[model samples]
Target: MRPPFPTPTAEDIRLVSAQLGRLARDVIGIPARCVCGAPTVVATAPRLADGTPFPTLYYLTHPAATAAISELEATQVMNEFSQVLAEDEAMQAAYLLAHETYIADRESILLVPELEGISAGGMPVRVKCLHALAGHSLSVGPGINPIGDLALARCSWTPTVCQCLVYDA
Candidate 1:
């Protein structure tokens, strides 16, 4: 049987957490800190208090609720374990498919017809999401320095918008 979700490695978790933080700051104009009270910077993978490797950053609630720091916060955090299984290629395939649905379901303003003028590229949605998240334009591509190659490899095509959905789902 195939795994049901993409499993980001410890490195993947750390990378995306940092990128999401930067987006929250530079793009969204909101300061992002993990529920654990860390400033959302990437460090070596964190282990359980028992020394088990805990990869993946799981945000359980939307930022507003996170800001309030309500007790319900714990409910929203998806353990990296339960987030999804990535052993199956089908899960990644499903992720891509679900992502396409997410794009089609979203409202957008198109500055370009297609990203590469090849695939559906999602440029329209990218622009909108960046603006909503960072209050900025979609010129934020994978080419940005803080966003290294691994971060790009994770959400390369839909650099600005897709990472949260892809990795965090």
Candidate 2:
């Protein structure tokens, strides 16, 4: 069993979102107009012990500015992470292992990033982060608008699933 919750504060989300946005602007070279178009902001998201955000399911409200941030930042984050995996063989293997586990246990699993670990109590643990879909239209929850269903569809991944398994309990 896991701790069943996320630990990132609203402030942490703000910090990471800001940092990531800066990374996207500086390192990734996405235009400020595009990056800042929707005014990126942070919210409580899940991550793993090594400080990687969880890629699990996320909820979005209709036409929320967060969706734009979610779309751009999510892709940027994954691309950045992909580079890391390309540079480190161990990281690549770890990513594969995590991906395998995720596919094998897709039912109980939501999002599965490599940062998860076992706690001192022998339960699973992960850093808290937000989730967002990149490419297609989805009928997620109530009142979540269809702003970027096409963007989500354009992502390399289909099914476009995202969620965070941890809870505040």
Candidate 3:
């Protein structure tokens, strides 16, 4: 089983800020990291401190992974994944399980009524954002998110590679 979330450090906030080009809000933990120690995926709170509902729990914060998923999105890979979800029963089951897992993970942190039952990446029904799916995959690991796994497989970037941390200065 995966470990619990790690507390975000000062360096984490700095790196996340750099990666996002703005301040990251309600970051609960660094669930996924790169080979060079940079955060690849962050688990965020379901509700922001300002009383806004933030539904996305696992956010992709690494510049390289985000860029790779963005490139995949530009090619309309989501449509292909949606088609696969429609055609395969087993895959659909797994995807639904993935959706359930995402919800449970978020609820484990805090149950935000506004964000209830809403998982990111168009889960259980469609493949909307590869970035979110891939972020989920990176946070949880392989076999949990098949669409995310496939997206990572098709992308140029991999967590095994340490490419982005060099620019962390």
- Where model 1 places Cα greater than 4 Å from the true spot, the runs are 1-85, 106-169
lDDT of 3 by residue, 31-129 (tens): 999988888888888889998988888899899899988998999878888999999999999999999999998888888998878999999899998
* Candidates ranked, most accurate by lDDT first: 3, 2, 1
Q: Estimate the TM-score of every prediction.
A: 0.21, 0.25, 0.95
The positional error of residue 128 in candidate 3, measured at the CA in angstroms, is 0.5
Clashes of each: 4, 27, 0
Q: Where in model 3 is the C-alpha error above 4 Å?
A: 1-3, 165-169
lDDT of 1 by residue, 25-93 (tens): 111111233344322222211233455443211222233322323322233422221233234354345
lDDT for every model?
0.27, 0.31, 0.88
- Decreasing TM-score order of the candidates: 3, 2, 1
**Candidate 2: C-alpha lDDT:** 0.31
Off by over 4 Å in 2: 1-75, 107-169
- Compared with the true structure, the alpha-carbon lDDT of candidate 1 equals 0.27
